[model samples]
Target: MKLLMVGAGLSGAVIARRLAEAGHRATVIDARPHIAGNCHTERDPETGVLVHVYGPHIFHTDDAEVWDYVTRFETFRPYKNRVKTTARGEVFSLPINLHTINQFYRKTLRPDEARAFIAAQADTSITDPQSFEEQALRFVGPDLYEAFFKGYTEKQWGCHPSALPASILKRLPVRFNYDDNYFFHRFQGMPETGYTAMVARILDHPNIDVHLDTPYAPGMADRYGHVFWSGPLDGYFGYDLGRLGYRTLDFERFTETGDWQGCAVMNYGDPEVPYTRITEHKHFAPWEDHAGTVCYREFSRACGPDDIPYYPIRLVEEKALLSDYAARAAGEEGVTFVGRLGTYRYLDMDVTIREALDTARAFLSGGVERGVAGVPG
Candidate 1:
């Protein structure tokens, strides 16, 4: 069978490779000149520092199979994401750990003492929380919420925290212990060379043909037995039902001699600051040494027609429109929606690859319908 995989990122590459290995020819196409999509990484010519072209992506997951699969293509160096934040004219550790709590309040409380203190600070009166603001106040109280989350969330989503869903804030953790690791996954690391190099290896199969800078067109699926669309879900239907809301990022790049910032990610928790976070590219690849450093100051805003969509803003209105699109996608034939954009949700790289593998397996086992793999029901 001849298969078509749209958008040659992790989703398309992993699925295409699996199908190609199963004696089926696969053609992968990406609109961008690069193959890895947002995960693309390249080195700065002057400083020789590897820069994450889009933003910093740390591969962290507890899925052993996914970890093993990626390691087959490229060597992964041990990396832990220890995020930092600047708030109220002070630097603090992320995830609201014990150190952060003590530092912010200027008290040397133990783990148990800190937990009780935070519990006391929480607003127990609000038994049921509906919005992001209420959720934070119920858990961490106003002081931590205002200093760390309020400004950053507003800047990232372009809305007041009170307008957002509580589920959005539920993902973040408030740690009572001193552990400052950003993620709680068992396995966390980065590709030794770069994500682009790793994806290139994944697409290097005999039965797979890769074409870059090629946008998907109407009737392109006519020639193939099946199509896996990883592009935007609304885009496949020409956005006839109106466009879905998304938050896009604007990165301001700068280069400096010597180390600019000691950390990889330094988030600004002050609403007054224009940018949300600053990432030092060289710190991403600690194994390699470079005298000069490259950094990106990231700003988030609503995605326009020509902008590259990053996060799907699935507020109440967007969710209703997404349901309409998902229903339309279910009725389509010989096409499966299989990625973050296609499914209209935020996805990590590990989850994307895992779902891609599963989608390929389902297709090889005779499930080629639109709603088989990742389509929302």
Candidate 2:
């Protein structure tokens, strides 16, 4: 069978590789010049620092199979995401851990004491929270919420926390202990060389043909037995039912000699600050040493027609439009929606790869017919 994989990112690459290995010829096409999509990484010519072209992506997951699969292509170095934040004119550890709690309140409270204190601070009056603001207030109280999350959330989503759903804040943890690791995943690391190199290896199968800078066109799927689209779900339908809302990022890149920031990610929790976070590229790969450093000051905004969509803003209005597109996608023949954009959800790197593997397995096993790989829930 001849298969077509659209948008040669992690989803397309992983699925294409699996199908190719199963004695099926796969052709992968990417609109971007590079294959890794948002995960693309390249070394800066002048600074010699490996820059994460689309932002910092730390591969952290509890899935052992996904970890083993990625390790086959590239060596992964030991990496833990210890995120820091600047709030109220002071630097603090993220995730609202014990250290952060004590430092912010200027008290040397133990784990139990801190937990009790935070519990007392929480608004027990609000039994069930609906919005992000209510969720934070009910859990961490106003002080921590305002100092850390309020400003950052507003800047990232371009809306008041009250307008957003509580599910957003539910993902973030408020640890009582001193563990400052951003993610609680068992396995956490980064590709030794870069994500692009790792993806290149994944696409290096004999039965797979990769074409870059090729955009998907109407009737392109006519020649192939099946099509796996990882591009925007609305884009596949020419956004006929109106475009789904998304939040895009604008990166302000700068180069400096010597170490600029000691940490890999430094988020600004002050709403007054224009940018949300600053990432030091060299710190992402601690194994490699470079005298010069490269950094990106990231700012998030509403995605326009011409902009590269990052986060899907699934508000009530967007959800209605998404439903229409999803229904249209379900009826489409010989096509399966895959990955974040296709499913219209925010997906981590590990989840994306895992879903891609499962999609390929289902197709190979003859379990999936058409438009059933990754449909929006």
Candidate 3:
């Protein structure tokens, strides 16, 4: 079978690789010139530092299969993400660890004492929290919530926490101990040669052809035996119902001597500050050394028509719109929508790859139509 894979990101690349390995021909297309999509990394022309072209993406996953799969293409160096935040004229560790709790409150409470103390501070009245604000207040209480999450969440989403879902705030781990590893994933590391090279390897198979700067639309489906679309779900349907919500990022890049922030990611968690975080690219690849450092002050805003959507804002209305799109997708034959944009959900790189692989395996097994049991409307 001849397949057309759209977006050429982790999902598309992995799907193409899987299909090609199964003795099927697959052609991959990406609107961007790059292959890795948001996770694209390249060398800075001026400073000679490795720069994450879009933003910092730490490859972290608990699945051994995913870890083994990614490492096959490119060697991964051990990298544990330890994030920092600047708030109230002070620097603190992220994920609300014991150190963060003690420093913010000016107390040296142990794990047990801190847990009890925080439980006391929480608003127990709101048992079933609906919004991000209420969830934070209920989980970590008012002081920590305001200090760590309130400003950052507002800036990142471009809205009040009250308007956002509780699921967003609860995504991060709340640890009583001092363990500051950003992700709890069993496998956490960055590719030694960066994400672009890793994805390039996945698309290097002879049965797979890659077309850069190409957007695969619905009309292109006629030319292929099947279509695997990783583009926006709303875009496939021409926004007939309504446009879904997304938060895109604007990166302010600058060159600096020596180190910047002494870490890879630093959050500006105060309302006074505009950008949500600053990322030092070189720190992501600690195995490589450079006298100069490249950094990006990441600003988040509402995603426009031409903007690259980074995070999906799956509010109640968008969920309704997504349901409509999913229903439509279920009725459309010979077209399979995968990945974050296609599914209309935020996804890590591993989950995207895993799902793409699963989609391809299902397709090769020949049990379903267009890799789905049914077609979309």
The reply for model 2, stretches above 4 Å from the true place, is 372-377
Residues 194-229 of candidate 3: C-alpha lDDT, one tens digit per residue: 899999999999999999988765578888998888
Estimate, for each residue in 308-335, the C-alpha lDDT of model 1 and write its tens digit: 9999988989988888898888888889
Candidate 3 clashes between residue pairs 3 or more apart in a chain or in different chains: 328-376, 328-377, 329-376, 330-375, 330-376, 331-375, 331-376, 332-375, 332-376
Per-residue lDDT for 183-270 in model 2, tens only? 9999999999999999999999999999999999888999999999999998998987799999999999999988998999999999
Q: What is the lDDT of residue 115 in candidate 2?
A: 93
For each candidate, what TM-score against the reference?
0.98, 0.98, 0.97
**Backbone clash count for every predicted candidate, in the order shown:** 0, 0, 9
Which residue pairs in model 2 clash with each other?
A: none
| Displacement of the residue 216 alpha carbon in candidate 2, Å | 0.7
Model 3: residue 185 alpha-carbon error in angstroms: 1.5
* Reference-based lDDT, each prediction: 0.92, 0.93, 0.88
